[model samples]
Target: MIIFIDSYTEEKLANSLAGRPGYFKLFYDTENCGCNGVLAIEILDQPLDTDIRISVKNFTFLVDKQQESLFDDALKLEADRSYPSFKVSSDSALYSTNVRIKDARDMASK
Candidate 1:
């Protein structure tokens, strides 16, 4: 699976973990954080037992089990100069890059 990380995000992650040793936890979860439906990215000092650690582009991602199905095959996360966040896309029609981040209240409508 090819997960593309933007230069900005990459630099940010590197800067965050430059001095710090050990593995930096990158949390990916499908939760309603705001109005739009989007994935959540969190940096943790430690890793959880249920976390799935994937190393891509010299960066580690801590994905949840429930979200693994969405990334079964080779998924790519492309990032450009304009885009600051990671863009996830897969060859499978079951999953799409059209995912939007939604808040708790917005999720209730769906």
Candidate 2:
């Protein structure tokens, strides 16, 4: 898949991940949303065995192999600072406009 993240999204990521070393994984979070899942970005120290890596620009993202089919062949991820949210869309559909970016290390420590 192809992902194009805008400058605004880059700025937000830089601010949040400055000095942090990790891989960004676009995860299909199915924890509490029932069958219809949501997309999320989790910062990880390493890629998982089942991850499908997608490289775009200077960023590398991973998607769970099991959930790869959930996304389209092409996608664009942009940050909307006004709403303080992430937007993901494809040529034909808008997957989400409220994706979350979380620090995996922080969550694991808790």
Candidate 3:
């Protein structure tokens, strides 16, 4: 699959991961929503063996092996500077919008 990310989104993402030793994953979270799934940006200490890595201009994102088939061949990640959020979309429909990054490392420490 191909993913497009805007410059603002790219800068914001880079800032989030700066000085943090870990992996950035575009996770399709299926937990607790019945059959519907939601996408999340998760910061992980390391990627799972089942994760598939996709590299963009200067960033690498990980997706679960099972969820790889769910993505469209072309996807776009854009930033809404007004709301200061991230959105993921394809040609026909939106996959994820107003996405917030979840730092798993910080959460686990709590």
- In TM-score terms, which candidate is top? 2
- Across 2-93, the per-residue lDDT of candidate 3 in tens digits comes to 78888888888887777676677886777996866778888888888999878877877888888888888788998778875689899987
- TM-score on alpha carbons, each prediction: 0.55, 0.87, 0.85
Candidate 1 lDDT trough over 10 residues, lowest sum: 99-108
Higher-scoring candidate on TM-score, 1 or 2: 2
The digit string of per-residue lDDT tens for model 2 on 16-110 reads 57677667888778897887767788877778899988886666788988888888988888888787668889999988889878878566567
How much does candidate 2 score in TM-score?
0.87
Instruction: Please provide, for model 1 over 50-105, each residue's C-alpha lDDT reduced to its tens digit, 9 standing for 90 to 100.
Output: 87778877777666665566565566554434534445555654333333222222
TM-score of 3: 0.85
Model 3 clash pairs are none
Each prediction's Cα lDDT score? Answer: 0.52, 0.81, 0.80
C-alpha RMSD in Å of predicted model 3 compared with the true structure: 1.9
Superposed model 2: Cα runs more than 4 Å off? 106-110
Q: Which should have the higher TM-score, number 2 or number 3?
A: 2
